[model samples]
Target: MIDDSIRPQLGIIGGLGPLASADFYFKLTRITQAFRDNEHVPAVILSVPQLPDRTEAILAGHDGPLAPLKAAVSTLNALGVACVAMPCNTAHHWYDQLAANSRAEIIHIGDAVVAETRRSLERGRVAVLATQGTLVSGFYQDRMSAAGFELCLPANTEFQACVDSAISLVKAGSIVDAAVETERALDIAQATGADAALLGCTELSVVAASLNDVNGLLVIDSNAALARACLTRLGFGTQEARGLPTVSRPPGHDWPMRGSLAVLA
Candidate 1:
């Protein structure tokens, strides 16, 4: 039993892909430094896997998928949640509209990731691993570039397809194959000389944690960044919420986002 009065509750609009939603929830629990259950942040996760595919809707110029997302936000708002975090990066293409229609403040996961990158890496060439819709939408590229960070992406269509395959595998509950595909994308990022890589897709973030550093290039999980931002907004210090050991690196070394592969709660 958790006490809501002591802390504001968080609403999660998840199920863009069920595994990604579960991954985000697991990361939220693991990252929080809670001695007891009540010490952890209370979250209401509305996982609707049946929600229409965001990328397909965007590519096809259809607004049908946005309806369910809008409804979900409205539901969370009516539940009296202090804020809402949607883990799906591609779905953020409809962020402004969703935020406008919902009463609860919708936290921009990409914005949070950009802020974290600035804080952690200052300004550097960053690589992005995301879906075609996310890349085509330029969500991360526009925001990160506006903040003075150069962005790198899969150079060719083949690499782009590889990234998409990884995301799809994760969605289909194929973690092992998803990891292999994700690693291939990371290799491309490394070859491009990226200072750090952003796992811009929530599904990619699920497998990214299992991968080791690629030639010293830090892999930042956008989901973890969003989780940290949520905790910070809820009055927890970033360091306090992240109880992991810090690595000894050179001055201003890029810090890879921390996450794990655990059963979804």
Candidate 2:
């Protein structure tokens, strides 16, 4: 086990949708560089699904979710976490509101997703598949365009309805149904001549396993990206924590492994 006394603890301000929060934690644990159980991230998960609907609050310009959300952050901060992660993409519309008086640094979900998308495609149309609120707020468009990606919304209301259906199905514990809708959304995305697709909603990220690089569209998942960002910020990327070998491979040696690059050592 590694010494964690000096390491920062991670906090999650989740449950904008219960399933998405659970999936966010799953992604965070899955991608961590830990080799042992004790080496995993020390995190505080506050899953209060009762918080007011983020999408509704944003579209209506109401602050309904604000008070409870601040309380959730306060609860986590009081527990001594160094940084906070809110996996829900729609909730990020209130990101600045939440981060202003926060004791713990709030991690912005778009930064990680945009960074990953930028790395994948320097310039191209990236399908923005997310909640109506996120789209209405121009959240992904504003951030991704700065990274040189032209964020494309599926040209019709039906596309967003499909995505919304998919998100609802997942939240209702219907993964199979959600996968079907997710597939439909991808089909619409492909119609946009997109080079990549951004799974900007954490609920969509839950069924991200159902997505692949099929048809040459690079799928960027916001939940997974944010999870990775948490690991980096919390110091889990340290050489000692990852336990990478001191021996360097020969310069000409090929790294034969899966794309995820989860080191075997």
Candidate 3:
């Protein structure tokens, strides 16, 4: 049985790009479904927006991201957070090092997103829209494929541009533009004839509702999936009730769409 007094505190190592970090925290709160004020989960957010660009570091090799990541871990650990979660998909490539030096439990956002996608969707063609680093790492494709799903992707150049635009918009605080970039990514995924598009980036959730034109395509929002997972871990919402509040279904809704991270692998 879980001990209420010993509930673990959640630590967020954010600013992997600032917007994603904020979105993850917001979703975590919104999905908690706390019946009493004291039931709220404790969270420690370290938003160091100056950290090395995760995608840039991965593509360009270890050109100095270790320091910031390590610092993030240190800050959260000092704050007594028992588990840490990073919202960026690309950052997961360096997760081993981040976890190696910390006693805090680290949650793999990318893996969580993929696992939820598998459980919610039938094993079939899945396309992931993310930064070049994430694609290059084969993080989503490799993990999903290992689970018996055929992972599809956009044309090389198109995928790169999508990643670039999403990051650029999010950093600029142009959330509406971020949503547009997500739609563009979905288009690229559809062009590849994918059954669905996995929004492998956390920023997409910040403006997920702004995307209203994704007709006949399933869109998976990883950040939202993570929120649900966090809530489930805290015993807040049930399996079916653990996600974004329901609204009027947009037109032509055929597949599932959640704004939380889904555990993939």
Candidate 4:
């Protein structure tokens, strides 16, 4: 029987991109309401930047990259975490396999966004700004379409290039340029008659909070959605999880990064 006195801890399989994982952690901290440190939800974060590139692995149809993620989930499960959340959107392509390999529940970030989008918007065009690999995988497309929402994407290769460039800029620590390119893509979405935009990439989510409204359309940040989902699943309320504090830059290495793993208890 599960111990009722011990609170459930969240396990994060991160480092698909270091910055995005850090951003998600920051959002998780700020979104929760806690007057003292112990009142906040406990989390175990495993950041493995050395894990093979998700996009490359997906395009190559190789299973090598999945090994590290599966291992991380296993480690978290061994630590007795109740649920696991992977901040990387592209990694969700292998969500089923990862979930199967672990004893703990894996929270699907894509599903969280799709649910939030459906609840927020009754029926209208939803723009998806994501990585090329994510777009090619059709992960969001399949889910959003089935949810009865019209999905709009970058119109051409040039627009797609802009989205890719923006993501790269964020990874390279050029947030200003990243925001500019992201805004350009949002403008394209607005021009295409999208009623809302979904920041489908975690890197894009890092910069999404700073973007101005495009033609008065709502912009959904996947990281925030995942954070709220984590809180709610842990029995926290979501009413105060509405907005995320501004993150000017990616978090430092104080938390685990690259090749190491740490359990925050």
Candidate 5:
């Protein structure tokens, strides 16, 4: 349960792949502390796990995925959420379409990541480890390029398999399998000259553990960034709430964001 002290209900359009939606919610919980029942932020999550595969639809030019995604956005907007966050990074490819149809402001994961990436690195190529759908959409490349940053990606085959596997494991709730693939994806990124990895897929954030597991490679967790942004917008950052309870958690163990690597891994 979240505290009601914070206002501005958050709406999430999720289940592009269920794992991603879960990841976002888990992070939201971890970002705020609940001293009383109403001290936490309020949120409404429309977890529609039945949406068709977004990557397949985008790559194959199918319409099934788009219809449901649009429906989700409309439903959330109708709920009157202050702002909407889509946990799936790949879904941001439809930024314009979703934003046009929904009244809720779309907090773009890619744009936020790009902004944070630039601030973190002075001049270095940052690689995006995301689903092929996101790659084809060019959301990261386009946004990061606009910010004067180089974008690197995995090979087509590797990228597809990595994303597919991550999705599969996450949907089945197998956090370990998801993490294994995350390490492999990072290894591929290292070989490709990536100075850092964008846990572009929300599920990958499960396996990757706060973007720091890439072995010295800076990781950018979009969900975390969104939480911070949400908090700032909620007026909790004001001096009056300065000492209020904060929602903080160790990386990867939190549910929705679960799937921490075992001691052996």
Candidate 6:
């Protein structure tokens, strides 16, 4: 249990895709090595799915997401959180800006995933599965390459299309189609001779689960990695929290889609 006097508070600048933000919170709570309520990390989540599409802005060379992302960080800072974490992988393209605006430490999902991969494997080809924005940003590619690991990108444009489809399906509340498309993307990554596949997008983490990896491929969940990193950074128990980074929903509440609230309309 953490002492009340110095218990570090966390803020989640979520809703990059909505469910991904909810999923990140669920992972953070579920994986915590807690015996009771006080053992878990205290967090506040600002789930505003109203933010502009990060991928669109990135690919088109627009700075549309910068204002809202920085605003979210400022809000969290005003709320007095000690650290902030955004689950979206592509949004890390604006990480430098977000970090610059925040009074708290903003945890980069890409950095957490890359560091987790380095810890899990000595040196190997890493297949990165992410949004086109993330790929175009070169945040993961540059960092991973500099870390001395070979990278296995999508086999072709079609592979990334499948990933994009999967991410969209999940956001639209189409879980089955999302899983099928996610499986397709994973299958393509597996054949790239890579030792492990990184689910670098938080949307991809929505359907992350145990699979029968015939080739013994290692799969890393970026959202879970970031959640775990948050735990470690906040002085929470993590060493013996959970076994695997399984897809978990925290209890009764369903994660709402982008415009799920009829009352708001």
- Residue range 120-213, candidate 4, lDDT tens digits: 7888899898886787789799989988889987565655777889889988987766876777777667767789999899999888776644
Model 1 is weakest, by summed lDDT over 10 consecutive residues, at 256-265
What does candidate 6's lDDT look like per residue over 1-265, in tens digits?
Answer: 4455754499998898887887788788887888798888878888889989999999899999899888888888877789999899998998987887777999888778877887789889988889889999999898888888889995566668878898998899876567666666666676557788888899888777633332477878898899988988888877533544544444442323222222212
Q: Who is ahead in TM-score, 1 or 4?
A: 4
Candidate 6: segments with Cα more than 4 A from true spot? 1-8, 210-214, 239-265
Native RMSD of candidate 6 (Å): 8.6
Overall local distance difference test of candidate 6: 0.79
**C-alpha lDDT (0 to 100) for residue 183 of candidate 1:** 65
TM-score of each: 0.86, 0.84, 0.82, 0.87, 0.79, 0.86
RMSD, model 3, all Cα superposed? Answer: 7.2
Identify the superior model by lDDT, candidate 2 or candidate 5: 2
The residue-by-residue lDDT of candidate 2 on 50-122, one tens digit each, is 8888888888889898888888888877777899999989888888888986899998999989776765677
Model 1 agreement with the true structure over 1-265: per-residue lDDT tens digits: 3354644479998888887888888878777766678778878999988988888888888877788999999888777788999999988999999999988788999888987787678888898988878887788988999999898874656557778898888878777667667766776666667888889999987876555456677888888889988888887544423433222334443223222212111
Instruction: Single out the weakest 10-residue window by summed lDDT for candidate 5.
Output: 238-247
**Model 3 — which ten-residue stretch has the worst lDDT?**
256-265
For candidate 3, write residues 90-182 as lDDT tens digits: 778777889998998787776677767876787778887777788777778777887788888655565558657876787788766566556
* Top-TM-score candidate index: 4
- Please give the RMSD to the true structure for each candidate, in Å: 8.1, 10.3, 7.2, 9.5, 7.0, 8.6
Candidate that beats the other on TM-score, 2 or 4, i.e. the better one: 4
lDDT at residue 18 of model 5 (Cα atoms): 71
Model 2 bad stretches (over 4 Å): 1-8, 238-265
Better of 3 and 4 by TM-score: 4
How accurate locally, in lDDT, is each candidate? 0.78, 0.76, 0.71, 0.79, 0.68, 0.79
